[model samples]
Target: MDPREGEFVDRMGLVMERFGGTRTMGRMYAWLMVCDPPHQSLTELAARLGVSKTAVSTVARQLELTGMIERVPTASREHRYQVAAGGWEHVMKVQFAALRQAVETLDLGLAAVGGDRPEQRARLEETRDFFAWTERDADDMLRRWRDSREDLDR
Candidate 1:
């Protein structure tokens, strides 16, 4: 692990808190990123993060479900976890899908509400446009990210 790992984890915790996630979620995530061997057992995570095994277990499950981390194969009954392969990219894909869904749902709303009243339609249109823009931007960024990774490989 990096010498600055604790500092980084704390910073991530603060950042994640702003995003409506528990600070432990971010700290565990940051620790996973820099931890040697990458994979960690619940006990290891708890010890390093100064949290309880139960807390680690709970947060780990949440992270796994969100596609941020994944369980590693272990012969022992105790499960170990590490950051998922392409996890950041997976996060982007999930968010992109959400943005697309939001746009679609807003479109349905626009249709149901009818277009004759500009006042009523303006807010819906603007919200739809916001999500639509986000979806388009995310699509482009994903493409660029793939291209950049390809270039790195080359």
Candidate 2:
């Protein structure tokens, strides 16, 4: 690993943890992102991140479920993992779906409060509108991301 890689790993660890994942998950993800050969066995990951293989395995399973990473096929029986294509896109989709759901739930709150309660209804209405707008904005951003992604590889 490069000397600067540790800083990046630490940064990503904090970032992933902020996103409600373990620091280990972020660190492993970070390592995978910058690692040469682009995929690694569980043992390599654990040793590089200074964590247990069990911890790496657990996070790898969770990350796979989230579509952030994938288990790569190897000639040997050992499993190798790497960052998945469209991972950021997958994360945004999940988050945007939650935002859409939030808007729906907020609308229900608005209905339960009724139009007669202006002050109570106002808060829910504002929140609902904001969430609806966020979903719309996210959709637009995702479109733009798709359009420009090819350039990103360059």
Winning candidate number (TM-score): 2
lDDT of 1 by residue, 19-61 (tens): 7789999999999999998999999999999999999999999
TM-score of each: 0.86, 0.93
lDDT of 2 by residue, 1-154 (tens): 7679999998999999899888998998899999988999999999999899999999999899999999999889999999999997998899888997899899899989997999999899888999999988998999989889877878
Q: How does residue 63 of candidate 1 score in lDDT?
A: 90
Score residue 48 of candidate 2 by CA lDDT. Answer: 92
TM-score of 1: 0.86
For each candidate in the order shown, give its overall lDDT on alpha carbons. 0.91, 0.92
Position 29, candidate 1: lDDT:
95
For candidate 2, the 10 contiguous residues with the lowest summed lDDT are 145-154
